[model samples]
Target: MKNWLRTTLVTLFGFSLLSGLLAGCSRDHHADWSADDVAKVRDRIAGKMDLDAAQTQKLDALIAQLQVLRSDIKGTSNDPRAGFATLITGDTFDRNGAQKLLDEKTSALQQDGPQVITALADFYDSLNPDQQRKLRQKLERHKSWFGH
Candidate 1:
């Protein structure tokens, strides 16, 4: 039971991380994404999931919250190694600095991760059995695409 719970949490975390990365990749480096941008992404995900009206609304709210969290993280990030230039310029390694960055990231995750996970799990649980099966199959197909 504990293993299953851990696996579930990890999978959900990976999904959230992948979604954030993909969203970031779609935008210009310095461009601030508007609410419409977030809405479009939420719409695309809802379409893929075949969510109903209520589900779509719930998803939209959840995505909005997550976008806020992402923005907060980006806005407060102070890592000197954030840019590629620092890596190529032979910058001195600062172990304490790295640890501080890691601590900040972990703190952010701890603060917001449970809310994201709970929203996801609630939405997933609300799916019909057939929809759940379809989702499982879709996940399996995606896994196979990466030779997992």
Candidate 2:
């Protein structure tokens, strides 16, 4: 009886945790967006990267392409499993589905990976070595000041 009770409690706890996580990632948290949405994200990224008007326009274009690629890879929230889990999950509990989804998300993340890296490289390259060092110090100081 004790063992059965313990197992039942564990199952209930796991179910509750899964439900909470799923609820957290529902429609309100989805990243579905149009080209205009990418423009806004691009604008925010531009501000973060200290980009000028021309650079912002270019970044917006790149973001639009990345958004399309991302959508294809991530799929709709309804089937948020990279387009294959729904099939596999029909027969089993789909424990492997989580790992598969994570792998796909990681792979999809690489879609815009190089461009973002190149953009950051270009920004740093444009700055003098002294400025780079100063920027690092400023960031560290800010982090320290915030008790982070």
Q: Which candidate achieves the best TM-score against the true structure?
A: 1
For model 2, residues 11-101, the per-residue Cα lDDT tens digits are 9899779766655453334365665775676677566666666655556556555555657565555554334435345756676766777
Query: What is the per-residue lDDT of model 1 for residues 93-118, given as tens digits with 9 covering 90 to 100?
Result: 45566576567767777788788787
TM-score of each: 0.61, 0.51
Error of 2 at 89 (Å): 6.2
What are the runs in model 2 whose C-alpha is more than 4 Å off?
26-32, 40-51, 65-69, 76-92, 110-112, 120-148
Q: Which stretches of candidate 1 lie over 4 Å from their true place?
A: 1-32, 78-92, 144-148
Model 2: number of backbone collisions = 0
